[model samples]
Target: MDKIIRIGTRSSKLALWQANTVAEQLGHFGHKTEIVKIDSIGDIVLDKPLYELGITGVFTKNLDIALLNGEIDIAVHSFKDVPTKLPEGIVQAAVLKRGDFNDVLVIKEDENFFTKDAAIIATGSLRRKAQWLYRYPHHTITGLRGNVITRLQKLEDNDWDGAIFAAAGLKRLKLLPEKEKHIKLDWMIPAPAQGAVMIAALEKDEDILEACKEINHEETATCVGIERDFLRVLEGGCTAPIGALAMIFDEEIKFKGTLFSPDGKNKMEFYKEVPVNNATDLGEYGANYILERGGKKLMREVHDIEKSTLVYSTKSLSHDQTNNLSSKIGVTSSDFITIRNNRLKRVIVKKPIKNALFTSQNAVEALLNNFSRVELDFENIYCVGRRTKRLIEKKIGKVTHIENNSEKLADYLVKNLDTKEVTFFCGDKRMDDLPTTLLNNYFIVNEVECYQTQLTPRLIEDKYKGILFYSPSGVESYLKENTANEIVAFCIGETTAKKAKDHFKNVVVSKLSTVESVIKSVNDYFQE
Candidate 1:
């Protein structure tokens, strides 16, 4: 084919490097190429983590659309980002020569942090986070997103001890330091197709397909195929932390795979080998082995964890603000009603408040504002959410049993707590079910209000395509000034969604109940 092939690619530095490299390879075979730079939704939205976006091909979807629409002849992408199931009419044309598959820890020039319990590691990938946490349970993992260069910059600018990055990406961009500033994390199993570049084109475009086939690396393609098959068979979508690596050596195929819990406390791993002739069945067999060895249960737990973490905020958030908040939380968003806290003049604890329970940061903030260490006495502090824990830590310098919700914290207390009595510092609008549930379980509960939530309904004269609600009161507040008959309502969780369904015709509930999840719900609905 003498016609010039158009290669669609992301405009990121790493993406451009991959595209240009592919174009140069194609040029070697006497095929003329044109590089077409395009921006993907994943690139445009930097506020949320990739998995929380709740889309499979967040990075490749734009290129897939371009290929289908004839805007480009072929699309170049990092194979790991491409969904196993390609969009209709598009298929993988070529798998380029594989590169370094190991993840690398890029640390600051002066920092010597490694495997330290007190060190913080920043990485946007769930696979990296789960594995790292599983190995170093004491180390903290925070979210870091952006292109390779931006991520590197973030590592330098932020106070984090280190950040995780792909070895292939750094090598491709020539960003790897000459010194020993980066350490290869060989302990981690690479995500499927991690170090390979995939070229995709219309399945029916025989000319382009034939041209691409000439440049395809058969060995890399075979190994990645096996790895992807394992991924598909396990059904480990973006929501779960999964890793797979396949290699060919001495005319035989070797595979290693792993599935991890969200918190990284539990995991299942598999290692297998087979003759070259039996490579086609290796992935399925390995997946079956893992599934039999508790992978099935791990997958279910991951799904449950993804759905159970709810972010129920009382503040009204716009879409952009919601996205920004989700980025900060390193997850999704779910906002609800408005909150108003009382100014505590003093926290007068006449007697000892044995075990103190806090439901929200508002209560902790109120307490800290009113009382110094001398004014309060408590044996231990337990809180519901991250915000509450941070606030309590700021004042009391310690917190325990930090759960995502009141129910989970209550369950934890009932199962292991030795304390006979507890004092709950909460808001005026706090629900009574948590205390009642504890009371029925034989634990003495004393409740004190430190803050209040006021429902302030604004006149939404302009109709919106969707309304986001984080709490039951938020739903009520939203409905006080508007109708939900024609609009879609995105709720944070089952409870909030249940309340939203009472008035809205079309309701979508975020499984994770985070602001990012709510925004993802909105995008998912509109994109559908």
Candidate 2:
């Protein structure tokens, strides 16, 4: 405490503000602090985006090196810029209380960009770029790389309609424009520990570490810990397009995370909340939730975007499935629907049930994912599709009945089902025909939503020779960002083919209702 703590920070005004704030906080504890300015690779490279630099902790590495050499007792950094894993011999000393984590849009013109068909928005961060595009797919995004002031100046010199920035930075430096000129993007999730400042110290330096702990905010630390854990589990580091934010309230912690492809074409996201005691691994669990559903494959696509593909699957496929296709037809895939088991766990039945129904494989997987086959048993399993029935038989039990579509399934259930009560496992966006029919037939339909399906529409930059759609939802998700009237539409069944016919000039339905059939149909069409 008696030694003067040397605080290393980037030379940018925003970083200096962080350092001076740290120095002021340390001063109150009777620890003398000296500000040592440092230049980071991020500051030196103004022409390239941070992700393009291909370096981890570009803004904090220089200061970290200074700390490692004992030139500075502690290194200050915008917590988001710090890698989830610290450098060797470096440990986090403190995390100050977080500031405004909302991203703000500084508009050079009016606020009509959202309604317009096309408008130019600028930002250097890939996370921001992707989120903006996901919301405004019709709008144009341009790159602007520099420090806060420099980026603002570039906006002034350019013809962009608006640019994005962290509200904490503009508010900390009192550079936030008037309310009319700027709007808060409340929907945008901030980077991990975005508005917080971090103090890094040598693990052996007990004095500095001890002194810094006095300024550590435990609540901020917990929230940022969750956010950073989510980021680390995603394995994106700083180079990928990822965003995460965590907040605590009323003895409960809430978290939200989003992952995007490198080109910002595809997106995956999850949100969860838990009691304070159960919040420790919530971030890790959330990341795993998406990964199991489809995120792992999407990230692989992001990492290998340079590879060209002639076919794009709205749903992710297994290694064998992709290899099932001829190597001559390169395929790229991502799950357009993010499947989540939020309702699956709570709605699981531990007791034996007479009649159970599944409309899609997603419902079967979602139910089995949270509740094991040993947990519950069903006497009669009636599913709308063969694949769904097969999954039920493989994972849980035998399927007594199977139908091609919901209407047929409803007719079969009404005529054959004698049970007064039936439980239907399905996603959030299921058609109401089966449930309505059962209800009208005086049956107690327990429509337990086993999973929630969210559509993640990604832009398809190039039209392939053909587009393969497994369901009407897949076709709808694809049409959100692309038109395929001229491209061949290979569908798994007549239901999917009917949907494709509305959007495409040519539609081909597989002879069988299966993915293998769809693939073979595609091969046959291209072969001809």
TM-score of 1: 0.55
Error of 2 at 127 (Å): 1.0
The CA root-mean-square deviation of candidate 1, after full C-alpha superposition on the true structure, stands at 22.9
| TM-scores for all predictions | 0.55, 0.56
Clashing pairs in 2: none
Expressed as tens digits, the lDDT of each residue in 111-194 for candidate 2 is: 986787889999988888888988888888898888889899999999999999999999999999998999999998888888
- Model 1 clash tally, residue pairs: 14
Instruction: Give the alpha carbon lDDT tens digit for every residue of 169-270 in model 1.
Output: 999889997557888899999999999999999889999999999999999999999898888777786767889999999988889988998778898888
Give Cα distance to truth, residue 396, candidate 1, Å.
Answer: 77
